[model samples]
Target chain A: MTAALEARGLRREFGHVRALDGADFDIEPGEVVALIGDNGAGKSTLVKALSGSLAIDSGELYSDGKRVTIDSPAAARALGIETVYQDLALAPHLDPVQNMYLGREVMRSGLLGKLGFMDHAEMKEKTQRAFADLGATVRDFTAPVGAMSGGQRQQIAVARAAAWASRVIFLDEPTAALGVVQTRNVLDLIRRVRDRGIAVVLISHSMPHVIEVADRIQVLRLGRRVATYDAKQTSMEELVGAMTGAISQEEAA
Target chain B: MTTATEPDRDAAAVDEEKPKSTLQRLVGAQAFQILGVLLILIVLFSIAEPDAFLSINNFRNVVVNVSILAIIGVGMTFVIITGGIDLSVGSVLVFSGVVAAKTMEALGGQGVGVSIVGALAACGSGTLWGLFNGVVVARLKVPPLIVTLGTLGMALGAAQILTGGIDLRGAPTVLTDTIGFGRLFGQIPYLSLIALAVIVIGAVILHRTRFGRYTYAVGSNDEAARRVGVRADRHLILVYTLAGFCAGLAGILNLAFFSSTTIAGQSNTALNVIAGVVIGGTSLFGGIGTIAGTVIGLFIPAVLQNGFVIMGVQPFWQQVVVGAFLIAAVYVDQVRRAAASRGASTRRSLFSRFSRPQGARRKEAQ
Candidate 1:
């Protein structure tokens, strides 16, 4: 299958340190690709470049075999690329429905919408359905997300991406701050998102989670794609060895 | 995860309770706290001085007295909700007032017609100043507090220069008699009516429109807003400009009500308006508030001042009481924030402490 997203020769430098050095990566439609690496492996840098949150010093990004430039988060979103960041993804003061439709509001038709009035009921119903479909129970739709459990907040963040992401979704350590149960919920949610035919790129430090959900594993070491493995065939020891440079791919082969 | 399970019946009972309805939730909201306080204050004052404090004349007096402050406080609510401050509102009010007075004086003093023209001029000038502030803070990326502080001095200095430090009086009696003291159907003062209209309109714009959502979003988390394609800079500009326009309206009201621009030590007006907004429970940190709360907040000070004067208490004591209330309001806000975060964590701990349910475990094991 043709890859939905591909990045070639991604290079970014921060004066003395090279954050990203010619990283090459790709993800296919309906595939879960876990981008894993040790600290300073440039996993975050590559994710930022792909999500249009940062500019690579040199790189080529392609969507469906066509060259594309994502200059800003909005540009990435226009191409159906959405990201659930580590934090600051939702306004704490707003409700789930409000947070879900923050920028992409549905306006009421005729004079009311022309006057900039939001169709709140419609948005709320859709947001409720999205949460239910994701198997997440949001007890209070009116309470501020800040007042909700961390897992519920994560669910809203993921559901927001699922609703808008048509081409690719980047989840950046989505469960880093969550508990084990919440992490499991997020992993299950990821599988559901993948089953819906959208490409998912998960940036995670949890090895078990990466192994459990990812269809393909892409390991980055020192700002470059060191290896890609089929999840069913690869071993955690081999992946960790590639990340820490303990064993060479040639030796493993 | 199974090792962490705690079979607590109380926790299960807590989980089985039904969620609150919209009305029930609203009644318990942070914004309604001041409404209760206001009602209590009204009861106490009426008992203390029945003839004076509860009289119709005193009621109209207090309402009219707070109209200008309430008008400016409405805009301040929006600004504070967006995590910004506009210190120049008072100076802008004076500048716009002066502009209205001068425009009327220069327009042959033809009563209400010329006064209308002068009001438009005042609003336009105030809006321009607000737009300047918005552009400086949004496009140039200067901090809002500093940008507004600088404009404050400039606006006040311009007003002083325009009038040579002298109060401008004597425009037209019709302007004062109709707009200043006029009543709507002989029941409500025009000023009070205008303030009511502004409050109603402001509430709609804030709670019903897309612009209102952007205001809360930008204030709560600006980076998140930008990430979601909200033009934060543009929203900032719109917020500042709306504030300026409100100040301008307040300026015209000042001109009409007083028939003069008193440039003597009016710098504290902005602080008073901000105090009212804060007292209404709009967080200084941003992303929370209601126009109704602000109206109640403005009335608190107005009622206290009026009641004190009638009860033979010193006027200075009003300031002390208002200052105390402002601190109390903010303290309550901080307390609520702490409770909210704690509530979230406690719920999560309960969920995790219980581990997976039996049905989920069977599915997972399979």
Candidate 2:
């Protein structure tokens, strides 16, 4: 089967620092692939390149085995790719319905739509459905998202991605600030997203989470993919060793 | 993976039991509270001067006097909601009126045709200034306060140079007859009617449209808006331009009502409008406000001045009172923001019993 998304030889530089040095990545359709690394290991840079948020000096991207170029976030979105950045990227002052339909508001029918009027009813109904489908419990439909709990916000971010993303969704440390219950919800959310037949790229530091939700794990070290392992077969110690550059699968081979 | 469990039943039950009564909602609105303050002032003034302050004529005069400021306030509301300020509105109004008055004079007719051209000239000039403000603030990322301040000086200076420090007079007689003073059913001033139309349209656009939503989103979190594919820069530019457009419209209205450009007047225009917008409940921090709040905010001062004059109080006291109101409004906003950040409900503690359900309390405890 064609990979949902594949990146080849991606390179990015910030003055003297080469953030993404010849990084390669691949994820099959409907698979949950965890990208793990220590600080400054280029995991984020690689995701940025693929998501079209960062410029890649040199790289080849393929969506569904077809060569493509994604120069902007809009372009990546056009290819059915979405990213939940660490910041959650939610307009806190807006309610979930507003934030969910921020750029892509559903316009009212006829002349009103032409006049730029939004159909709040339609948007609200759809947003409600999306949350219900994701099993995310949002208490107030009218309150600003900023007033919500961290877990609720995380669910919003993830559910928003799941609603729009058809090909792949990239999540950056989705559970970083979440508590135990919230973390469970997010992990369950990831599985639900994967079940929808969309590829999920989870970037996380938690080895247990990676092993739990990810079908495969890709380890990055020094701006490059250093190891790929079957998550079910891999040990946390081995994954840590690969991330910290203490183990080389190539050398072992 | 385990199937998604239901949300806590207590929380769900509490959410379903929320009060849906109109009175409950009205009491919760920021605008309603400001309106209450306005009503109290009106009542006090009436009690003090039943014959003068309580008359229909006095109310008409007050509304008519504020019509131009109301128009400008609508635009200011949009700007402030976008996390920006436009200090050049007063100057821009002067500049646009000058241009419109000049256009009508050159056309040399008191006919409706001349009025049409003059109105367009005013709106066009205002749009240009707005466009300029938008470009500088959005493209160059200059702080809006400084940028508008710079334009305030530049626009006023430019107006002075164009007219040689003299106010332009001679708006078309037809415009001054119809739009300026003409009223429906001989009761409402045409100026107030026009102001009403502008306010209604502004409210609708701000509350019901995608553009308005983007305005709030941009103010709330610009980076988030950008990430979601909103051209935040373009939107900011549009918002500033809209403010300019309103000022321009106000300029034409000013000419109609005053029969002159009033270039030397309006020194307090921008400040008064900004204060009214804030007093009405729109935040300086952006992301939260309403046109209703701004309308009430503008009225607080207008009514104070009108009522004070009839009550034999020095009208200058209106300024002091309005200043107090502005500070109080902002203080209230800050307190509410502090509560919201702390995850407490925005409703006052008295109303919190009705608003926050048991589920919310349990969640907070956790």
Candidate 3:
């Protein structure tokens, strides 16, 4: 089967420094791929481009082998590509269901049409299903997300992605600021996403977690992909050397 | 003696939200202050004019007298809830009245079509001025208070220029007589009934629709709302437009009440409308208020002034009392905010304790 997400020659630049100077990465329909890089090594640049928050300067994106251009966040969503940023970008005062169905509320009436109301029942049912899939129970459906802990909020964010995503997902430093238990909860969620036959792209600084969860690992050093190795074959030291541009295929040869 | 640390807190936080909720329902709400004042006035006034002040006709007269301002206060509620103000509403009323009367005079007296055109022109002109204020504040990024203040001056000048400060005396009597004097449901004034109808529709628009939620959301946290794909700028524009429409209707009602349109009504209206809005329980800071509070707010002055006339109080003293009420209401709001802040800081302290280690690590987090 074709990979769920494939990048061919993705390039991006910020003024003088090249953040992403032609990169390609892929994940199979149910596999997890880890992208590791040092600070300012273009991890965020690639994440922003794939999430449709920033335009790619020069790149080709293929999902299930069909080329596509994502001009907006909605367009990326249309392709079933969900990206969870570090900040989570959730409305703190809005409940989980409200945060989940924010922009696309399930309304009974057509836009500017008769009835003039939102269908709260349909939205509640759909969100309940999402929560069930994430293996969590929200105590109060109307309680705001601000009242939730870091772990619960991440679960809601992941659930929101899985509810609509069909092909691939990206997680950007998802464990940042999370407690040990919270990190474990999110790692479990990442595994669950793959178990559902969806490809997962993980961006992280934690090398140990990467080696544990990733089927394959890709390393970027100053915007260029320097190495890719099967998780079973590579060591943490080898991965770290590739990530910092210290290892070269020519040297190994 | 034991000493206690009350707490250092963010006092302004609590006052920033709409108070139409359970907070306003609390006993000792400022709206109840008007009722206290009304009772005091009744007790003092009846001793002086025992027969006259207690008469039913005197009660009816007071309700009728305050009807104009109360009608306009309904419009102000919509404006203030969106965290904006309309200073030009009074001027719009005057300008509209002039247009309506001038239409009657120029149309050769009270024909049905002439009356309809006059009403539309007056209400329509007020709405047009309101739309101008909304566009400047919403799209052009001008402050609401300043834009409406500018329009207030412009509207007054336009009203004066339209008539050269002359009163349009010969208005169509039929139109005014029906609206001002006709009884609805056997005893209710026709104008009051119409005002009631407008208020019901307005309250529904503010409380029951998707439009209402966006209004509250924008006022609450604009950036958060926009990030969630809520078209905030567009929603703000719509809010201002709704305020303008209400202002227009208030002007038309004013014209129908008084046969002659006076340019001076605009002078006191902005302050009065804002005072009435805050009097009801909505916050001046934005994000938390309701039409119900506004209605209660409107009646405070209505009942107070009614009690004053029964005691033969001078008309100028009315302004003093209203001013005092405004200052007192603000003071109460300040006190309420202070207490709420103390509660908030206590909650924050509890949270800080729950995650003390996290706090220590956060400082070294870089």
Candidate 4:
């Protein structure tokens, strides 16, 4: 099957540092591909390129074998790409329902809705259902997100992307600041998203988490794809070696 | 597997939930506090001057007097809600009033229909200036305060240039007398009624519509709103334009009520409107506020000024008292925000604490 998203020869430079250097990555439908790398491994750069947050100097992106151009974040969203950045980018003072329906609010069906009135009930119900499907509990539906715990806030961010994204969802360091329970919740949420048939690109620094959730793992070393491994087939030692440039693919085999 | 301590633990859980509800309930309770203050002021004034303060005519006078400021307050609410300040509202108001008076004069200001056309021109002029401010602020990426300040000077200067530093007089009698002083159904002053209608519409737009949702979202975090495919730039422009439209509406009201452009040094006008919005519980930091709160905020000053005048207090004291309330309102908001955040942290710690196992579970948890 053709991959849902494919990027080849993606190159970006910040002054002299080639943040992304000829990096190639792809994710198939119904796939949870964890993009892993060390501190400066260009994992985030590649995600930004695919999500249309950053401009690339040279690259070819293919969506289901059809090459496409993503010049802006809006363009990327138009092509069904949604990103949950590390910051989560949520309005702190808004409630879960409001945050979930932030940009793409559901309008009422009649004249009032046509005149830009919101369907608050539908938006709330949908948000509640999304949280329910993820098995996540938002203790107070009306509380501002700033008042939510790190994990609950993370869930809202993921749930928001899940609600709107049809093809690809990129989560950039979703659990970097979350505690153990919250991390598990997010990982479980990611798995459920994959089961929903939307491809998920999880960027993380945690090796165990990458192995625990990712069906396919792609390692980036200094702005280049170093190795790819199946979660069931690969060992942690090999994954670490691939990330740190200590072992080559020949030796890993 | 209910332990002997299960019931007690459930009680503990309920006890723990007490603070969370308190935090969520702050918004409703805060509105009540403002209302209480308003009530106390009204009662004290009514008791002090039973004949004057309690009279229906005096009450109507206060309402009509506040109508102009209230109209401007509506637009300022939108501007401030988006985490922006429009220092040009006063200038914009004067400019639109002048434009209306000029339009009426040129169109043979004789009938009510001609006055209506002039009012439309005033609104258009105000919206045009507001759109200009929006473009300079949004497209050019200039700060709102600076852009509005620039427009503030330009608008007032243009108004002065139009009438040669004189207030334009001779507006159509329909505007000054018929709509200005005439009662609606022989009860409500038309000017005051229009202001009330504007407030109702503003409330519905701010509280019940997608535009209001976006306004709050943009105020809270414009970048986040943009990331979610909201054309935040366009929204900012629209918001400023709305604010300008309100200023225009206020200008029309001023023209009718005062029977002229009434242009002068209006530096205090913007400050008063902004003060009212902030006092109403709309945060200066943005993303949190309500229309009802703004009405109360504006009314406090109106009541104080009217009551103080009746009770033989100086007019300057009104400013001092209103200024104090502005600071007090913001301080209360800050305290509530701090407590809410504290509640969130406490809840988080409690969740982790309860989830952690006796001793062995803790070690194996992460």
Which predicted model would earn the best lDDT? 2
CAPRI-style quality class for the chain A–B interface of candidate 4: acceptable
lDDT of 3 by residue, A1-253 (tens): 8877788778888898899888777778888899988998888888777778889899898878888887677778888888877777666545677778766666666763244466677888989987777775344566446545566677788878777789888888887766555567788888888899988898999987888888888887778677888998999899888876778652243
Give candidate 1 regions above 4 Å deviation.
A250-253, B5-18, B343-366
Candidate 4 chain A lowest-lDDT run of ten: A244-253
Evaluate residue B208 in candidate 2 and report its C-alpha lDDT on the 0 to 100 scale.
90
The DockQ for candidate 2, computed on C-alphas, is 0.45
- Model 1 lDDT tens row, A1-253: 7789999889999998999988899999999999999999999888888888898899899999999998788789888999999884899989889999999999999999999999999999998998888776566788788776677788889999999999999999987866656667778899999888999999998888888899999999988888888888889998999899875553233
Tens digits of per-residue lDDT, candidate 4, B1-366, equal 235343333322322332257654553444556877899999999999999999999999889888889888888888888999999999999999999988888889479888889999999999999999898888999999999999999999999999999998868887777777889788789988888899999999999998998989999989899888788899999999999999998888888888878788477899888998888888787887887778888899999999999999998899899989989888877765664454242322212335655444313322
Kindly indicate the candidate among 1 and 2 with the higher lDDT. Answer: 2
lDDT of 1 by residue, B231-309 (tens): 9999999999999999999988888898888677469999999989998889898888888888888888888888889
Write down the TM-score of every candidate.
0.93, 0.93, 0.75, 0.90
- Tell me the lDDT of candidate 2: 0.88
TM-score of chain A of 1: 0.96
Error of 2 at B309 (Å): 1.0
For model 2, residues B76-100, the per-residue Cα lDDT tens digits are 9999999999999999999999999
lDDT string for model 4 (A95-153, tens) is 98999988788999989888889998998888889889877657667778877667778
**Candidate 3, backbone clash total:** 4
Worst 10 residues of 3 chain B by lDDT: B6-15
Give TM-scores of the second chain, every candidate: 0.89, 0.90, 0.80, 0.87
Query: Across the candidates, what are chain A's individual TM-scores?
Result: 0.96, 0.97, 0.92, 0.95
